[model samples]
Target chain A: MTTAPRLTLPAVTVGDRLPDLPYDVTATTVVLGALASRDWRPMHHDKDFAVDRNGVRDIFLNTPNQAAWFERYLTDWTGPRGRLGRMTFRMKGSVFPGDTMVFTGTVDEVVSDDTGCGWIGVDVTLSVGGDLKTSCHARLALPTTDDDNPWSRSGDRWTP
Target chain B: MTDLSADIEALIGVEQYEEAGEFPVERGYVWSTCSAVENGNPLFWDDDVADALTGGPIAPPTMLSVWFRPHHWAPGRDRVALPLQIHFDLKEALGLPEAVMTENTIVFHDPVRPGDLLTTRQILRSVSPEKTTKLGTGRFWVIEVEYTNQAGALVGVESYTGFGYRRAGSEAGVAP
Candidate 1:
């Protein structure tokens, strides 16, 4: 298996744009995310309930499902050593099956804290056909050197 | 007619409910979640790789709340109710027929691991006055949910915001 390259703190720039991740959303994808997150909400898996009861077009992604997707998107770019500190997102619209959701992100800031933990700020947006569905702001910790692993830090050294 | 505005006003900053997950964190759950998201992070799949970084394998930090999500059905539970009770309470009180999540924020304090029994407590954060938007006339509310492990250490906290609204032409009242 080919391993993804580790992203070092010194390599990231304030304006670096991560590669776009486009996913063809499907009913199965929606249901899988809900089931994996253990969210049994009907709006995420029951099309009839979503259409007839919830008045939505169809079953859409749940909150945790979206969170998982965001995590995947960020970690994919940061490789395995990246650690998420916090994330905030706004859902402006729904993502239905048959829509192609494209994730785009850019590095807004990069900093090294007093504890020597390297942090990267990212702003991401999920859009379908150029219409915004969700916008997320996230902060993540990355390694400063090859031997530096953010996850290995704890106690006084792990303030994120 | 019930005064939803008044009722919701009284609920702000009050603890709505506290509950524990049906089961502890399981490796199978971590696997399924990773598979669903198509994540190939060694931290979630390869123990040796994770051990070098975090002492052992760790669940995705975003899964903090997932560990506390109650099962759909259990032996003792005879009926099914919506997961977040406070959201539905505002919906029913406001006569809103539909609700949608508008915003969410989560702060991760610790990594989750298998066998960790998680519990969550939810509190009503704020409630907005009724306003008309593209979706319809509705009030927005935010709920803060805190997650803790069996040892009572904080794992994460989430602020969830939702809008309960009456669709256009729906007979539901939005209160004066």
Candidate 2:
């Protein structure tokens, strides 16, 4: 098994763009997410119920799924060393099953506190076919050291 | 309608609340959810990766939401309905113009792996009535649902905001 490279802080910038992560929303996928989250709402899994009842084309993506997408997007950038401090998101549109969703984000801002911990703010968005499905702001705690080693110091804020 | 505040108080601050049924956590189900979120990472599907990170097979963060089923009410039993079906029948029951998922907050205490039996108990946090353009008067309810594993370990808590709306008299017949 190949281990992911340890991510370093101060590597990302305000203008840096996250890679576009693409995925297909399938019936099986939707049901699986609903089952795992224990969110057995019919609008997330039942096709007929979504169409006939909610007037939606298909089962929609739940909020937790959207948040996970953000987490994945950031983790891919920060690697294993970054820690997510907070995330706030708003679901603008419904993501029906079969809809291809793409997640993208940018480093909105960055700052360092008195303790030398790097605080990065990001504006992340999830889109389906060019339409915005969810948008959120996230704050991540990164290391201030330039050393490539993530474990150089103990009790770092990014450990957890 | 059933004294929402009172219903909420009875459910909150309780350690072990009863659930209607159990939903199995299958490997296929975990992969499916990860795929839907556009996450193709092998960590979620590959056993080798799972073993490296978690020291065992574990479910993804979003996977927990899919595994939760509503608390089913036996005919005469006292059970709080979650209105899970109302999301589908919005037009008939409330004539809701739009149902939007506004926000979500989740806290994870433990990892949910395969073979972990889970149960959920929901508590209504707050309900705010507001006005909308398409749907005149609407309500947004914040519900906090806590999930625990079979061993009585708190797995996570999911806070979801669901918005229900009704059509305005003037815009009721207007076609978009």
lDDT of each: 0.85, 0.64
> What DockQ would you assign to candidate 2?
0.32
lDDT of 2 by residue, B1-176 (tens): 34334543463344334463345666776766666555555556667856765566767654556665444434665755443433333333334555666777665556677888888876656555455645466667666667888888777676767776655654432322
Candidate 2 chain B least-lDDT 10 residues: B83-92
Model 1 chain B: lowest-lDDT 10 consecutive positions = B1-10
Model 1, B92-124: lDDT tens digits are 777887888887899887788888888888888
Residue-by-residue lDDT tens digits, candidate 2, A1-160: 6335444456767888877778887787667656545566789878899999989888887766666667778767775445465566787888877798888888888887555667688888889899998888877666566433222222333321
In candidate 1, what are the lDDT values of residues A41-63, reduced to their tens digit?
78998899999988989999887
TM-scores of the candidates are 0.86, 0.64
